[model samples]
Target: MFTGIVEEIGTVEAVEPGTDANGVVTDARLRVRGPLVTSDARPGDSIAVSGVCLTVTDLPGDGTFTADVMPETLRRTALGELGTGGRVNLERALAVGGRYGGHVVQGHVDGVGTVLSRTPGPRWDEVEIGLDPALARYVAEKGSITVSGVSLTVTRVGDDSFGVSLIPTTLAVTTLGSLAPGARVNLEVDVLAKYTERLLATAGSAGTAR
Candidate 1:
């Protein structure tokens, strides 16, 4: 589990693809260079890399760690799109007794969204993301959403777009700082909203059946 609060912005050191005996592509091994996260990392631990929870396979003891990316994970998240030296938002798993600064995050990417617009400010910038119409129902104004592993509030929502404000700190610390229009990003909607919608739908179905 994570809180969606980015601890540090890490760099993608390497993405090595593995192949099967038949020469078919199997999976990819990712090595991320994060001085802060790797300082305390260990094998078998979980790290949220760009909003995808990956198990730490090798610490390497060099301010970098390795994680295996399966084919299914590659298909479902934006991590596969990364290349060497790409910027990525990183957050360590929520520790016991830690303050919950951001909303609940599972490090599971629900889908991919594209940047639509960016309105810059002296101190902050408002970003609009074009999401799939199906995900609009899960987004609400003033609610929280995870974008590329950064926790932010939705300032507005539309049929296929939502807006978020990035403060100066966020711009300096995370990949969102350099996000441009048309760039793809990983998106995870509020889990509470999804659960509420599910319960309401189930109740409505039971009422209709009675």
Candidate 2:
């Protein structure tokens, strides 16, 4: 589990694809440079890479680590789109007794969202993300949403989009600082809301059956 808190902005050193003799992609490996997050890293540790939870397969030292990316993960999230020198938000698994700064984040990207617009303010920037109508119901004004591993509050919500205000610190310390219109981001809505929705649906089904 994670808290949607970004610990560092890591650089993708390499993305290697394991191809078979037939030139079919069998698997993929990613090398990321993260000084702070890799300080105590080891193999088998869980890390959130741009809101996708990946297991550490190798720690090659020099403040770098490698993780294996599955094909399904690639199809579901944006990790497959990364290239060498790309920037990614990195965070270690939320440890017991650690500070709970952000909202509950499983590091499971539910879907991809597109940056619709960005409005720069005197002290902050408001970013609007084009949402999938199915996921928009879980998001509310002032609620929390995890975008590419950074936890932020939803400032506004529409039928097909939502907005978040980014302070100077957020803009400087994470990949969101460089986000522009039409950028793709991994989005994880509140897990609690999803659970509630499921329970309500189950209850309604039961009532109808009776």
Candidate 3:
């Protein structure tokens, strides 16, 4: 599990084939090895690579690690569009006694959203993302949402979009600063809201059956 807090901005160094002889172009395989992320890493350790929870498959020397990207993961989220030299938000799993600065984030991206607008202001910038209709219900004004592994509060919600305020610190530390309109981003809504919705729906159905 993660806290939706970005630890570092890492770059995709290389992408290689996952197989040798039975070489079929499946999903895009990648090896995103970066410093500060693999300082104490090992195999099976969970790391949020741009809001996607990927396990460490291999650990090469000099702070380098590998993880596989399947076709389903590629199509479901925005990790497929990454190429060599692309910057990505990275965060390690929450430790047992670590401070929970951000909300609970499973690092499982629910869907991909498109960047609608990024308006720069005097103090901060307001970023609007065109979210999916299905996920729109979970987003509310002042609710927390993880965009590309960075936890941000929704300042406003429209019919199919939501806005977030980004301070100068956030802009300098995360990949969101470089995002342009129409770029795709991974989104993970608040998990607790989904459970609440399910319970309410189930109770309503049960009551009507009487």
lDDT of 2 at 76: 78
Error of 1 at 6 (Å): 0.8
The TM-score, computed over Cα atoms with residue i paired to residue i, of candidate 2 is 0.96
Ranking, TM-score, top scorer first: 2, 1, 3
Q: Candidate 3 clashing pairs?
A: none
Best candidate, TM-score: 2
lDDT of 2 by residue, 102-183 (tens): 9999988888999999999998998999978998999989899999999999999999899999999999999999999999
Where does candidate 3 stray beyond 4 Å? 17-25
Better of 2 and 3 by TM-score: 2
Judged by lDDT, which candidate is best?
Answer: 2
What is the lDDT for 209 in model 3? 100
Query: How close to the true structure is residue 192 of candidate 3, measured as C-alpha lDDT?
Result: 92
lDDT value for candidate 2? 0.93
TM-score of each: 0.95, 0.96, 0.94
Better of 1 and 2 by TM-score: 2
